[model samples]
Each structure stands twice: as structure tokens, then as C-alpha cells.
Target: DQQVKQNSPSLSVQEGRISILNCDYTNSMFDYFLWYKKYPAEGPTFLISISSIKDKNEDGRFTVFLNKSAKHLSLHIVPSQPGDSAVYFCAASRTMEYGNKLVFGAGTILRVKS
Candidate 1:
């Protein structure tokens, strides 16, 4: 069973506007949530992350919020720019015997239009 899901396949936002990407998880054991951004022909880069102990985390134009009760999370980007257009992946992890293993969503494509 897939642990993470990004229901929306794509989203479009105007430059300088706000873009919201949503994700949901079924595993209550997940202790960490992460969002990654990927450009065309490039690997995904770490963007923002939130721990289960916290509800929100922010970094400049990016923010991540986790709702444990709902098993949902969202990534927000204010003043979205054209360069921000890319695929975003939501991942979750929990501590294991060896280490943490990430369970990733299918990914959502974001288009920031100028």
C-alpha cells in the first residue's frame, strides 16, 4: 500500500502569487515529512521539512505544514517565480532498526506562469 499520495497531478500559479501543494499520508508512524523540488532533467533538491512534533516549518519563500490528525501536509510558496516551475515530491519517513527510509508520493507538477 502506498503511504503517501498527492491527489493533484498539477497546479498553476501566476508569478508573484502564492502556490499551494497538498499531500496526504496513511501511515501514522511517520515521524518526518519533507518536500523536494526538481527541475527538468535534474535530481530533486531538498526544499523544506517538518517534524511530527511541529505543525509548521518555514524557509524564506517556502513553508511546510503538517496536520497529524488529518494525516495531511501542504507546501506553500509565496511570490512564486517562473524558475519555481518544477515537479514537487512529498516524502515521509520513520525511524527503523537501521535508519529512516523515505516513502515518496507520485509527485505534483507546478507551473509558475509569468
Candidate 2:
């Protein structure tokens, strides 16, 4: 079973509007949460990330929030543009002795309508 899940498979927002992408995880041991954006025929690129200890993290127009108590996380993009359209994947991981055990959600397709 998938430990990480994105409840919504797709989201559409008008350009210059706020786009909020949500994710949830069943694993409580996860210490990190990350958001990745993938474009057509391109590799997924890291967007924003938040540590479980912190409630929120912001980078440019992108912000990530983590709610450990709820086992949930979200990415918010302000004034979303056409260029922001892509598939977003939420990931969670915990550090182990050997490495990190990362689990990814199915992904949410974001369409920014201009």
C-alpha cells in the first residue's frame, strides 16, 4: 500500500490565482516533506520542501507547509502562471542508518489557465 497519497488527482486554477496542492501520509516517522514539479518529457525537479519540525517554508512564489499532527502537507503557489502547470509529487522520507526511505504520492496535475 502507498504510504503517501495525494487525494486530488488534478487541480485547475486561473492565472494569477493561488494554487494549493495537498498531500497526506500515513507514516508518522517521516521527518521530511518535499514537493517536486514535473513538466512534459522532463525529469521531476525539486520545488519546495519543509521539515517536520517547521510548519512552513517559503521560496520565491512557492511555499510548503507541514502539519505533523495531521500527517499532512501542502504546497502553495501564489499568482500561478501558465509556466507553473505541471505534475506535482509530494514525498516524505526519514533518515535511516543506511539512507533515506522516500515515499512519493501518485502526483497531482496542476493546470494554470491563462
- Maximum-TM-score candidate: 1
Q: lDDT value for candidate 1?
A: 0.94
lDDT of 1 by residue, 1-114 (tens): 889999999999999999999999999989999999999899999898998999999999999999999999999999899999999999999866325578999999999999
Poorest lDDT segment (10 consecutive residues) of candidate 2: 94-103
lDDT of 2 by residue, 42-77 (tens): 999988888888999999999998888889899999
Clash pairs for candidate 1 = none
Query: Which pairs in model 2 have colliding backbones?
Result: none
lDDT of 2 at 101: 60
lDDT accuracy of residue 6 in candidate 1: 99
For model 2, the stretches where C-alpha displacement exceeds 4 angstroms are none
The per-prediction tally of clashing pairs is 0, 0
* Cα displacement (Å) at residue 17, model 1: 0.8
Best by lDDT: 1
TM-score, per-candidate, Cα-based: 0.96, 0.95
